[model samples]
Target: MKERTIFQKFIHTLVDILVLLSLAWFIVYSFFSLYRVSGHSMEPALSTGDTVLIDELSYRFIKPKRMDIVLFQRADKSYNMKRIVGLPGETVIIQNGRIYINGELLETTKISPIALPGLAKNPVELGKDEYFLIGDNTDSSEDSRFQNIGNVHFAQIRGRVWFRLLPLRKMKLIV
Candidate 1:
């Protein structure tokens, strides 16, 4: 009788462990995904090969705002990470290595200096569904400033980067 009781307890504990594991799997697969940074575009804030937790569900309830780092599907069928500098229906310009929005100068403290000018040299007006994106490392990123990439459409946005998971020394919530 005692052996049977021990066996039952073991089965009960096994079932509980399985249930907890299943719940964790469902939440991670449904609401979030792991993303790895591929380039230096987001340097200083994020680095190449940094694995991040992408919150894919939040965008469903909220539109992306300025300064938000987003992962987007590029025209070439690749994913690129960049910071949102101009929102929909806004004018963005880059001149003399600086960014201007709606004729107002925006102080850029994150990105590297732009040594070369791109489409932003002229006033680029964003449509209602367009968002201007640029890399924190403007010197190396090919973002909305290029004709091929242009402005990121609302549909192309995949998710917002929320945290870093690898490189324990650098791990933290990405603000």
Candidate 2:
């Protein structure tokens, strides 16, 4: 009887562990996604072939902030990664190879001069649900400056990229 009771306890413990693990797997699978960087547009920040983990839950509770690297779907239903530059209700214009927000020069770190202002040569106004995104490598990026990708709607954003996971040695939190 003693031996049978011990085996039953062990089995119960095993079932509890399995249940906990299953719950954990479900949460991670639903709330996180992996994205692989594909081009030089985000160079000097995220390189091609670098894998990153995206948090799909945070944006549901809070709005995305400027400088946040995000994964959003384009009009053609393709995904692209970029940094948030201009937010809702703001006017953005690129002139003299510099970016101006609300008639003031925008200051940022590590951003290169714009070679082509594209549609932003004229002031581009953002709506309440719109966001202007740009790649870190301005000259090489096809972003809000172009008509096709003019402004990203909040609903089109997939998630915020927060961690770099691949190329083991370079693994770190994406700021």
Candidate 3:
């Protein structure tokens, strides 16, 4: 009798753990997710292999703004992280290796210098609900500056990166 009781208790504990784990997975799947940075395109801000938390709900209430780092849905359905440099109906240009929005030089602040200029080297007018994205590490990033990925629509944005979760030393909310 005691042997049967012990076996039942062990089974119950195992079932409890499984139930908790499944619940946790369901919550994360529906409300949030984690993405690992794949390359150096976001260098100095986000490094390769950095794990970030993506908030899938924020854009539903708020529109993406300039300098917001987002996970963009590419034409091939893959996702890439980049910063918003130009908004809907704004004109973006890369001249003399500096980014200009609407004829004014974009504030570089903490961003790396754009060396190649790429496609945005010529002024591109974004359409309504269109956006221009670029990487913080401009020189090496293949972003809206390229012809193939130019003028991303609002529908292409998957979510905004809200926080860094790994590399414990740098774990914090992304601004």
Number of the top TM-score candidate: 1
Per-candidate count of clashing residue pairs (backbone under 3 Å): 0, 0, 0
Q: Name the lDDT value of residue 46 in candidate 1.
A: 93
Candidate numbers sorted by lDDT from highest down: 2, 1, 3
lDDT of 2: 0.92
Error of 2 at 90 (Å): 0.5
Q: Comparing 2 and 3 by lDDT, which wins?
A: 2
Estimate, for each residue in 58-139, the C-alpha lDDT of model 3 and write its tens digit.
Answer: 8999999999999989998889999999999999998877889999988867468878877787889999999999988876
Task: Give model 2's TM-score versus the native structure.
Answer: 0.85
Of the two candidates 1 and 3, the one with more favorable lDDT, higher being better, is 1
| Candidate 1: 10-residue stretch with minimal lDDT | 108-117
Error of 2 at 13 (Å): 14
RMSD of each: 2.8, 3.4, 4.4
Model 3 lDDT at residue 119? 78
RMSD of 3: 4.4
TM-score of each: 0.86, 0.85, 0.83
**Which residue pairs clash in candidate 1?**
none
Question: Model 3, which residues run further than 4 Å from truth?
Answer: 1-28
TM-score, predicted candidate 1 vs. hidden true structure: 0.86
Cα lDDT for residue 58, model 3?
A: 83
